[model samples]
Structure formats: C-alpha cells, structure tokens
Target: MHGARKAFACAVILATTALTSGQSFADEEVNVYSYRQPSLIQPLLDAFTAKTGIKTNVVFSDKGLGERIAAEGENSPADVMLTVDIGRLDTAKQLGIAEPIKSEVVAKDIPSQFRDVDGDWVGLTARARIIYASRERVDQTAITYEELADPKWKGRICTRSGQHDYTLGLIASMIVHHGEAETEKWLVGLRDNLARKPTGNDRAQVKSIYAGECDIALGNTYYMGQMETNDAEPEQKDWAASVRLIFPNAEDRGTHVNISGVILNKYAPNRDNAMKLIEFLTTPDAQEIYAETNFEYPLTPGVAIAERVKGWGELKPDDISLSEIAKYRKAASEMVDRVAFDDGPAS
Candidate 1:
C-alpha cells in the first residue's frame, strides 16, 4: 500500500471510531463510493442498515469514481463501489480495482448473463434499450435495431450522442450480433435516418418525439417511468403520453439490456461487512426495493417487476451476455467516430 493511501485510510478509521464511541455497531460500517445518484440507492442502503445495523458511509458522484479508487490504491477505504452500466464496471475491472464477489448466494441469485465471468461485478437491476415511437406519427407495432437503418425511416429518428454509454452499449451489441464490417454499415444507415443531430439524454429524445421533431427515439425502459411520474415537471407527463414503447426485436434476438451494478472494491477495509451488504442487496426483499423505488427489473428470477414498468411492455432482453457485448465496445465507439454518426444525417 502507498504511504499516503495508508495514512488516509487510517485517518478515516480513526474518525469512524471516534464517531461510534457509544454505538453497538459502530465498527460494522461499510464504506461506499457510488457513481449512482445517492437518491437512487439511499432506500436500499437504509433497508440494509435497518436489517443488519451495519451503517453505510457513501461518497457519491457521477464521474471519475474509478479513477479515484485506482488512485487510492490498496488502502482505498471503499468497501464497495456502485454504478450503472456494464461499460463502467468493465472499465473498473480493467483498472484492477475489483475483487471477485464469489459468494454462492450471489451466484445462485443473479443469472450468469448479469454477472462478470471473473466475479468482478454483479448486476442488481436491468433496463432495456427500447424505442420510443410517437403514437400520432409512427404506426409501427414492432421494430428491430437493424430496421432503424431502413431507408423508409429517413429523417424520422432521434437519439442522444452516439458516443453516450447507452448508445455505445446498443452499438456494441450490434457489433456482437453483426460483426464489425456489417455493424459499421448499419451505423451509416442509422445515422442517415436521424431527424436531427443526436442530442440530449433519453428523456430529451422523448420530448423531441412529443414536439413532432421525430417519430421515434432510442432510450432506456426506466426513463418512461421517470417521465410519467415526474410531478416536479408535470409537462413530462404529456411527453410520456405522446409515445409508445417498442421492445426492439422481441420476436428474435430481443432488446439490448444493460444493468445497474455493484462491485466489491479490491481493497475493502471491512470485507465481511461489505460482503454481507452485497448479499443483502441480492435478497428478494432488497430486490423489491429496487423495483418499487427505481422502476427497474430485478435480477432475482422470481421477483416481480414494478407494475408501472410492466405496463410499458414486456421486455425480451437479448440473450448475449453483457461481457460479450462489452468486448465490442471499443469497436462500436470507433465505428461511431469513423461514420461521423454525431454529425447528424448527411444532407
């Protein structure tokens, strides 16, 4: 361990010890470094604490978390790291900051496709990348990822930056399915079909559909829930009302799916407690919290999906493992740049 990292870890230990002077479970805390928004995971953490009395200390941010932990080295106080997306989790493994989450409980609960082959990470929830098609303008009952490139849809699709992880994930899946040469050709076709320069987050794409700027868009399944239930921005309800969800390729290879996952930090100071929390997270009760609170599909086989999520449509996820898809991410990203996909449809 580096001296600076060791010293910092020691300081954190001492501070935690001081704070827990009178508490029964003071020494049972687990440190978390999360790339997910705190609000998204707070309920789960609270449930864990309530069940086991193991307190969670979290440092949350959306960017640079992997770099932060890598810089912290062997003495990193982070017991667990949480984030969404296979790309980020694979990046952490490549950075060498992960420990195998090798619990029989986890292996049995989470399906193989949702787990890293080396046990470096485990997915807790899954969301599909589906098409949001305008109810008024688009009459298609079904679509395929490949169909997006058909000349019939020219100047009729909207999307976020092709470089975004969500877009890249879908693109990566395309590479896995079609190989580099054909996937590259598909990217050109899809790029030319764009209604405008790929811009905005998934929600923004839905908003564009509402405005008649496009007839269809690519977005995650859960964004629909967030938009429909958005009381703070009630206008989002109308946006949600304007579109219908299409699970691409439901009759064939199925829609591309991604996960929100957790990893056991390589240098977990409280390894046992961290493992306990991880195990707790996979249990049916915790999985229920994930579904009800986040409107996501639980990884546990028997757990029910959120009713609102079910209302959107049945999701038949692509059977290819995320690890397989991740293998093609670099190629997918390069293809995006090579095709000048973000430049919008060539006029």
Candidate 2:
C-alpha cells in the first residue's frame, strides 16, 4: 500500500513539476510542496486564491518533499511546504531548505511553543496523543501516560509500533519530563503490558478495542472524528462508539500534542506571494477552515474548533516546547529498540 501511494505521489509530482518548470520570480502563483493530501488542503488553497487573487500550485507526496525541494536547489519552484509531525518540520529545517518566517502576523497569531525558535517553521493545527479506552470494559474517567505501564493493565493495552512518529512523539515528551533512564524503564514496563505485538495505525487500535481485543489503545484525537464521520465504512463509527477519548496527563502536565505545520522554502521564486499566503494561513478564517477540514485544533487562538473535536472535551496541551520534544525523538526511537517494545508482552 505504501509503495502504491508513493508511486501515485511520484506521478503527481512529475505532473506538477512539468507545470512549474518554467516558473520565474515574477510569477503571480505560489507553488506548494506538501505531505498533506490535496483533497484535505485544497479548500484552504482555494480560499487563499479567492481572497488574495494569486493562483496556488501544489506538488504533494506522502514523503520525500523536503529532500525533493533541497535537491531542486535554488531553482526549486516550491514556495511553501506543508506537512504533519514535528519530526518532518525539524527535518526541513535541518535540510537547509527552510526560510525563516519573519511575519508579525505569524508571531502574533501562533503561540511561541508551536513555532520554531529559529523561525524556520510554524505549526497550523494541533492534535493530542490520547488514550482510547473501551466504553464497555473501562470504567476509569481518566488516565496518564505513566499509568499505561502498570501491572494491573497487563495484557490490556494496544498501540501502534513504538517507532511510529506519533508514539515516538509521546515517548520523546516522556524523555523530556522523566529523563532517558526513567523513560527507558517506562518503555520496558509498557512493553510487558501490551496485549499483542504492536501493529496498525491509530484507527486500527480503536478497531481492536471495539472488537474486544484490548481494553485500551493510544491514538491521536482527530482519528476519533474521522472514524465517527466515516460514511464509506460504517463499521468505523461503531469502533469510535466503542471507546472513550482520554487526554493523557490532562490533570497534571497536560496531554502530549503534536502539530501539522508549514515552512517557507529558501528558494521560493514567488517570495512575496508566499509570505502573503503564509500570513493569510495564520488568520482566524483560514485557521477555522483548517480545523473544520482536518478535525485538528487551530493553532491560532480564538479560532473555532470543529464541532466533533469540541465534543471530545477540552484539551489542556502540555506546555513543554515541541522543539524540546524533537530533540529527544532520536533517543526515544533508540529506547523503543532497546526495550524491544514491538516484541509484545514478555511471556
């Protein structure tokens, strides 16, 4: 499936490249390289074009966008890059393809923690890494990231692979709070509590809970909204119905949250229009459209959240800097391997 997706993405990129090969600095259009699907983001792009009178051109793929832009060097037509996960945003900064954002609008609208200290990237929306507890078997009203390791929950927890970006993000946050030594111990304990070998995406874990294969699983909050609204696969609605969303650590440090973010390409040919687009994206109207489209929390304060997202209860996001979490991501991946977390419960 991944290969198929990559192949299709390559075809799309080739087509977009053909269209953009002749772009010059004087062009009125802004070119975008994105990891987000066009369907998921087209509304915002359309809205931008409608408001600003500048055409938006997009090249999209599930991965390799930053590398592609870097490989294109100064001739790259990409003006803005859009993607999810702190890891990808950090990688764009590391690749030297990101131009630091200096917009006063961005600084005023986005919180400091969600924007890079170096100003290379800024988050647009947020999602909490939360627990999906079975409505039938779990009576608890709340849980913490630390409690997933308790002996009482032995053979009860389910999750995707620890190496996945979402899991790594949470583990990275744990390392930030508890240190590497303590975080490793927690991973070992959590490994022993798994119901089965780690597998599947966030939505799959919720399916497992609905099937009674596990009492709890870790997943992002927007997935609940997706599952609940899935008309194509009605079974997912039942899966969503079977679990209660628990924002981990909400009572203390708050839930571990990650972002979907954007970067300005260092080689942008349409820099002025790109800056306008970037600044426009930070406005409340664009943020509201983003939140409604993706079921994610708006990064701009006071933007309305999606109705389904609001029903999940209020989110008190962990106040820790995401850049700090990004720093420990490598260490967190190492801890996942050191503990052999995907090997499932120790028999």
Candidate 3:
C-alpha cells in the first residue's frame, strides 16, 4: 500500500473479451498495466486492435502499477506492463512482478545492449542526457561531459539533483569509464561549478540558463520538445529558445542515454496476446508511433526519431551497456551522498 495506486478510470474492470459491443466476447484480449499516460500509447493500441482484432484494456497510472500487480499475486489480470526507465524496469524484475520474454522475434527486434540479458525487460524508445547551453553566452560549438568539470565553467553550471535517476544513470556510466575515484573527483569539480544548489527536474535547469542564473545546464533531449510545444506554459517556449543542445562526449563515446521500456507481467493471464503486443511494439511502424508521440528516439534499428528531436542533430549513443551501467546505480547513489552533491559547493 506504500506506493500502490489503483487507476481511477477502470481499476478492477474486467477485460472486454467482447470484440463488438452488439456481440458477445471476442476471440481474445489482454489487460495492460501502464505507467505511461494512456494518451501516449492509445493511438498505437487502437492501431493494433484495428489490425489484430484482439481487444486491449488499459489501467493507467503515473505510478504504482507495478506494486498493484504484485499485490494481486498469481491472480493478477495484467498481461503486460509498460513503463519508462531501465532502473524501474529492472526493479520490477527484482520484485517478482515480471517474467522473461523469450522470442526469436523479440530477440531480433531489440538490440541486446538495450534489453535485459535474460530477457526480463525490453527498451522501447530512447532519450539522451544532454547539455542546455546559453545561446548568447556560451561560445563553444562542442562540449563533453568531462568538460563540465573544467574550472572555466565555475559558477556557470546548473543541474537537477545528482541523485535524480537521469543524473545517476549518467554518473553510473561515468563510473564504467573512469572508475569510482576519478569520477568522484570529477563530480567534485562539477559540484563546484554549480550556479545554484542541485534542484528541480531537467526543464527547470533549462529555465535557470534562460534566467541568466547559469550559462549551461544538463537536461534530457525530449524536454526540449515539451517546452517548445507547451501551450499551457508558454514561457517554457521562451525558456527552450534560450539554449542550444550539446550531446556530451559526442565526438568520443557518444552521449549518455536512458530508455522507456516494457515487461511481461509474471501473472499475465493472456500470455500469447501479451507476447503479440510486445512484438508489435518493436516493429518499425509501432516504434515510429511511440517515438513521434513523445518526441523520443526510436529504439528499433533504422526507425527514424521524431522530426523535432532530429533537429538536435545526430546522436551516437554511448558505447556502454545499460545492463552493465545499471549495476553501478547503487554505488553512484552512495557517491552522491558521499560528496554532498546537492548541498551546493563549500562556502
């Protein structure tokens, strides 16, 4: 009950096996537990149902779908689980809420580097942790993660908490490259360069750069898309216009990336249908729908990224393996506390 939440739209609704409202139950259907907003995935689901005629039912929540399923135990109706962040996906595996998905099609569709080695989870799309540099103040056309620590940037950098998932993933990847000691030293330099105490989500960092509080900030690539297109918050568009994106380590190992992905529920009642859904999601067409809807990059090989995201320029994903990078997350979290990274620099 701690983090569990029942979806208000249809928490315990029975899966409508009824294909046609006027008719009885259809051939088959699947129940989906989704952390992603229903709007982002509904178009693809509608397309899938239109094609396959297999009815799909959704229980959407911003958080707690995983815990809710786990509490249901073996009787849970969830056929598939969809969420973002490999860390959360991996946690679901550790929690016994997920079952391995082994299929020749699934194996071939998702690159091994972006999925679980044992096939417990699979990445569906990608996002980069990129720098938001002031268009007017920053003169450099190129930059690297290593350079964020350089003394020249002192009092000029902004970031969310070093403890946030995005930053932790970046640091975990750094540990993979530089080992813990040197990475800790590098973190100290980055902390010293802080324009303010580490705070807020990625977009808030971009706003800091816009406000003249910092010359550069670290943020996710998709947030630029949200900011620019936001109608409710028009000021975010101005915030977006103030900075240019820089994919750190672009010339070398490439930028750090995180993913939005899926898992097969351990208690899936409609196993075959769930497998069908997962495979369908990885197809080039489905990947495009997912990518374009969220302004994210497609994970399936050769599928084009969203046109808006494309304008940021080509991204060569870092050479590190997400499975390997996930291994260092705990150490990276400890390192953040070890350095007091969110406390601002020493006075």
Best by lDDT: 1
Q: Which ranges of candidate 1 are over 4 A from the true structure?
A: 1-23
In order, what lDDT does every prediction score?
A: 0.89, 0.88, 0.85
Instruction: State how far residue 281 of model 2 sits from its true place (Å).
Output: 1.2
Ranking of all candidate structures by their TM-score, best first:
1, 2, 3
Estimate, for each residue in 146-197, the C-alpha lDDT of model 2 and write its tens digit.
9988998999999999998889999999999999999988898899999999
Residues 230-344, model 1: lDDT tens digits? 9999999999999999999999989899999999998898899999989998999999999998889999999999999999889998889999988888888889999999999
Looking at candidate 3, what is the lDDT of residue 312? 85
Poorest lDDT segment (10 consecutive residues) of candidate 2: 13-22
Candidate No. with top TM-score: 1
Q: On a 0 to 1 TM-score scale, where does candidate 2 land against the true structure? A: 0.92
| RMSD, candidate 3, Å | 3.3
Q: Record all residue pairs in model 3 with backbone atoms less than 3 Å apart, i.e. clashing.
A: 17-26
Model 1, residue 87: C-alpha shift (Å):
0.4
Taking every candidate in turn, the Cα RMSD to the unseen true structure, in Å, is 3.3, 5.1, 3.3
Please say which candidate is ahead in lDDT: 2 or 3.
Answer: 2
